[model samples]
Target chain A: MKKNRLGEFQELVLMTVIVLQDDAYGVEIQRDLEERLKKRLSVGAIQTALKRMVEKGFLTSEFGEATQKRGGKRKRIYSATPYAHQVLREMRDLRAQLWDAMPRLGTSQA
Target chain B: MKKNRLGEFQELVLMTVIVLQDDAYGVEIQRDLEERLKKRLSVGAIQTALKRMVEKGFLTSEFGEATQKRGGKRKRIYSATPYAHQVLREMRDLRAQLWDAMPRLGTSQA
Candidate 1:
C-alpha cells in the first residue's frame, strides 16, 4: 500500500476528525459534514465510509464511554493516523500547486 | 439519493475530469492526480474508484477509440455529471466557509 493514500471522502472525514479532535465520532462527524458542507449525509453512508477508511489504515477508532448523549451507547471515536495526515498534506499541496498555476480569471483578484 | 453527494477522491477525480475537458479518461485522470498531487495512484485503485463513482451517479464513462498510447485497448473516458459539479460546488463552499471562519494566525500576510 502507498504510504500516503486516501479516498476523497476519507480525507474530508479525517479533516473533520482533526477539527473535532477528542469529540470526533459518528454523530459529530455527520453533524459537521452536514452543517459545514450544507449537505445531508446518511448515517449508514458515513458509517460505511468510516469503516472503509479504518480498514484502509487511514483511520483508527476506539470505543468511548457511554454518554447520555446517546442513551449510554458507546461512541466510536476516530482519529487520523500520522499516515493519514501525510496523505492529506500531499493532496493539499497538489491542489494548491494547480491553483497557483492558474491565471486569475475573475474580478475577485482586483 | 441526495441531490449532491460525493466522496473526497471522487471530488478530486471529478475536478480532474472538468479540467481535462474532452480528453478525460482513466490513464489521464490517474496521471493528473499523481503528477499534480505528487502522489502515486495505482491504476487499479483509480479504475475501481472510478467504477464506484459511476455507480453512485457521480460520473459517467464511455469507451474511447484506442490510441497508440495503449495499443488497441479502449480507454474509458469519464466526465462529471451536473450533479457531480453541484456536489463539488457545495463541498468547496463548505470548506471555504470553514477557512474563512479561522482567525489569521500566520505572518505570511503581514
Candidate 2:
C-alpha cells in the first residue's frame, strides 16, 4: 500500500473532483465536500489536499476563465488523471481480493 | 478511515492467522506470509505485528503444549477476533463503495 498509498482525504477529494467534472475548482470542491460530509471544512484544507494530489501526479490542474462571481480571478480547475484511477483500481482490487479470500465470519469455509 | 485503520501488514497477518486456524503461530504464520508474498520476512516482524494486534484486541494468543522439536518451548498460537473481521469488513465495504462510485475510465458514467 505504501508504493501508491492515497491518503484518505486525498482519495475523497479526488473522487469529488471526478464527480464534479468540469466544475472542480477550489470553492466548488469545498462546497460539495461540506455538503456531502455534513460539516464545514476549511477551504485551505481542501486546497492543501488538492495541491498535494496535483504534485503526486494523481491530479492535474489548470486555470479556468475568469468569472465575474470571483471578481475576475480564474479558478484553478482540477481533474483526476488516468494514473489516479489506475492506482485507485489497483487498491480496490487488492482490497477485494483480501475480502474474498477471507473465510467470512464462520461459515462452512471456516 | 483513521478510526480503525489497520496497517497493511497487520491486515495480511490477521487474515493469515484466520486462514491458518488452529495452526497459527509465529513460525507457521511467517512461513505462510513468506509463501504468499514470495519474500523473506523476519520472525520478529511477524511477532511484532501479532503482539500489536493482541494489544489492539484484534487477536488473541495462547501457549500450546511444549514440543521437543523446539527444545520444549511452548508455541504461542494466535487467532483473529470478531473485532478484526468487523474492521476488515468495514474497510472492504468502504473500498467497494469508492470503486463503484468511480466512473470507469472513458465510460459514459464519466
Candidate whose DockQ is highest: 2
B-chain TM-score of model 1: 0.85
lDDT of 1 by residue, B69-101 (tens): 646688788877777767666666665565454
List fnat per candidate, in order: 0.27, 0.33
| Model 1 chain B: ten consecutive residues of lowest lDDT | B101-110
- lDDT tens per residue, model 2, A1-110: 23455776677788888878889999999998787666688989899989888878899999999977747788899999889988766656655665666666667653
Give the per-residue Cα lDDT of candidate 2 at A62.
Answer: 93
Best by lDDT: 2
lDDT of 1 by residue, A1-110 (tens): 54445666666777788777778899888998788767788898788878888888888999988887747788899987777667765766666565454334355642
Candidate 2 Cα misplacement greater than 4 A, ranges: A1-3, A7-20, A23-52, A64-76, B1-3, B34-48, B66-73
Per-model TM values vs. the true structure: 0.61, 0.67
Q: Write model 2 residue lDDT over B14-76, tens digit each, in one string.
A: 888987888899999999878776779998999999989998889999999887784767889
